[model samples]
Target: MTRSISLIPSGFPFLDKKWGGIYRGGSYLVIGPRKSGRTLLALQFASECAKSSEVCLYFTNMRPKDLMIQAASLNFDIQSYMNHNLLVVVRIASPSEIYDVPNPDDYLAEYLHDIVAVVNQYKPNRIVFDELTPYIGFRNIDYLNDVFLKTLEEVEDKNINSFFIIGEPATQKAQLIVDTLRHSVTGSILLKKKAEQLAGQFYGGTVIISPNVGHTEGQFTADYIIEPYKGISVEPTIMKTFTRNDSESEERLPELSKIFKPITKIKHENIDDMQMNFSNIYSIEDFHLIINNQIALFKSTGQEFHLVSLKLDSSAILKGLITLNQLKNSVGKSVQKKDKICIVENTILVLIAKTNAHLLNEIIKKIRINLPSRDEVYVKAVTEFIKIYTLEISNSFNNSAELIELILSEEATNAHLTLSELT
Candidate 1:
């Protein structure tokens, strides 16, 4: 008979949406490089479980006092949980502190025994082993396996959910240790710095190496940012796009249409007969309608077009460095009559029809030349001050909203143009 496993919230919207929460009694491995926010993620999970009245045991090398303070800094109410007996913080000594003692193996064995004893006493519904690296390095593979297996068996017997946080392996022995533990766990998550540059900065991402509940085959990755009060927040747009299954494409249209429902429902009587005016700057709502029509036309005819965005620093405008009219005029003079301009917040969205990347760069250069700057010093800092992001819209995109969302997310940087680099 198949075993029935309960489910618990992951405390993250993106993760919960992707996997429908995690298995109640399952154990997972969360591996990441130093400062990649692995501990914070695990802490967030434990805190959320505690909030729901589930008992949680958090084991870490740091002092319990210090760990509680750190959790509070991230706005996690760890102290309240502790007061109510919903959360227990255990302090495990660092390997360096215990390795110097006589019969260090005996000390390690005693530590594992105490932890198991505590679990049997408290019967926590969730457990976390933070930074298992020190123990992995303290003993041989056999001893390490013995310690890990002992704890895993206890948790499994009690049907307790667990998370084992470890640093990315830097040596062969460490890799072997991690690999062995990985197979025994129900699933694994890898957090690391993004390899590619996004907006001139390397962002962090979380990859579901093996999910226990849903879509277990293919890997899913999502970008994330760490904040003081928020802990780790995943970018919802990228997560929604990347983690969506291909089979659900048919159901996604109506949901995507709702993103721009207000703009689409507007009645424009002579939209088709509208004269082309390159110098005219359109509002955000009108621009949305035009882009939607353009995208629909491309879907039916298979013709491609380019969407370029000139993102300006709002601080520059407030500081009297440049005026919106001056920037719009500069951009207007560079494009042909077929191109359309839309002002969205601090960005100027341009629709370039029947254009290629080479010609796009030429137009960008002309716009840069037309921009009014005080002197050569200001001209040299144009690239540093402003950003140019471009995306080529093709039949691959389902709707205009999706394309516009991708551009707004700043992920469509395949053909980004730097103003200073342009001759």
Candidate 2:
């Protein structure tokens, strides 16, 4: 009888077929930008390998509990593997020490010793080392070169398939390490965030594979999406070119609608993804339409609606998003079920229905006090960073567009208004 294919599935059909499955003694490097689903893809691969193999080992600086939480966020059942003895997770002391020892003098020896110890103990068929950047911290580039080659040899000697997850290179040294590691490894998978005018972004990315690995040759790239619910789904077509080309090049290409297939967009329904603390917020256009409907309803029912406009800085959007995500639960508790919250670029909008203007005033005041400020140590607290504007939707407007225009005009006016003036 013929032996079955020994390739292990990555749970991504196109990826599996392209590579002919991950084989034993193969080493791979998975590289991507921050928050670009690098960890998700690595864990997804590990989860699939564990299901079919005797053991798969995962090494990370994250605590086992935190790791599990992260896996759960991606809808992965990592705990099941842990329970079944099919997966072994080891947490290093700190990210910097992944390839460093307690003493800088003995760093390389200790680093290799730690890796050898884990591999010997687990004897795992598959192994994953997540995030190789911190380990490269302040270390001699040549020493790191030796460590990479040695680690590959050690894993290959044991005939174990291994994956090393590395963040996108931020410095010249990092790029060197990445290039060296990619060349040494049996294969390399590159993940990058792509915001295509054609493809709506919910972590849509491109994957490129190196030559002479998993039946793939001469380099190949495919577009894929790592969705919250669906996990990773590679698009039907191989990406011949990047969607984010220069304006000159973009202008020369065929019309986007004609050249590109419509990628599946993420629809965030009201209160989508119960597992997350934050709800599925709307965009400015969607928020405007809803406000228009609310105005008509207010005219017919004679009910009042309140709109709270919170302004933020474009430079601090990422920081603001993180702060808002952390405080979403607190904000949700303060608002009613009928209230709607949406972020429009640098502004956060909270629309409350069937509430008295006076009560909303009080709520707004409380929000001013409770909301976090970008500055903390100054003599006078600077809540001036976030400008808030409260508006009562008027029913006298002829149409939703008119009402929306008025609201937008007022929003612009409020940008110049100070918190002191409001108080």
The digit string of per-residue lDDT tens for model 1 on 1-423 reads 566876668765556676677877888888887656677788888878898899988877755434543464356656566778888876665544464568665555555556677788778998887766655553466776777778888888888888888777766556776777776787777776565544333236654445544444434567787655456778767763433354533211000011100000111111011123454567777777888888888888867788888877765454334445557777888888778888777778899888888998899878877766433334554445467888888667877788788887756544555566554
**Could you tell me which residue pairs clash in candidate 2?**
none
Query: How much lDDT does each candidate structure score?
Result: 0.66, 0.59
Each prediction's TM-score against the native? 0.52, 0.54
RMSD of each: 21.9, 16.0
Runs in model 1 with CA error above 4 Å?
A: 1-3, 97-106, 194-203, 212-218, 240-423
Total backbone clashes of candidate 2, pairs 3 or more residues apart or in separate chains: 0
- Please give, for residues 54-95, the per-residue lDDT of candidate 2 as tens digits: 688887765454455456544556656676878777665443
Q: How many steric overlaps are in each model, in order?
A: 0, 0
| TM-score of model 1 (CA atoms) | 0.52
What is the lDDT, from 0 to 100, of the residue 412 in candidate 1? Answer: 53
Candidate 1 positional error at 378, Å: 34
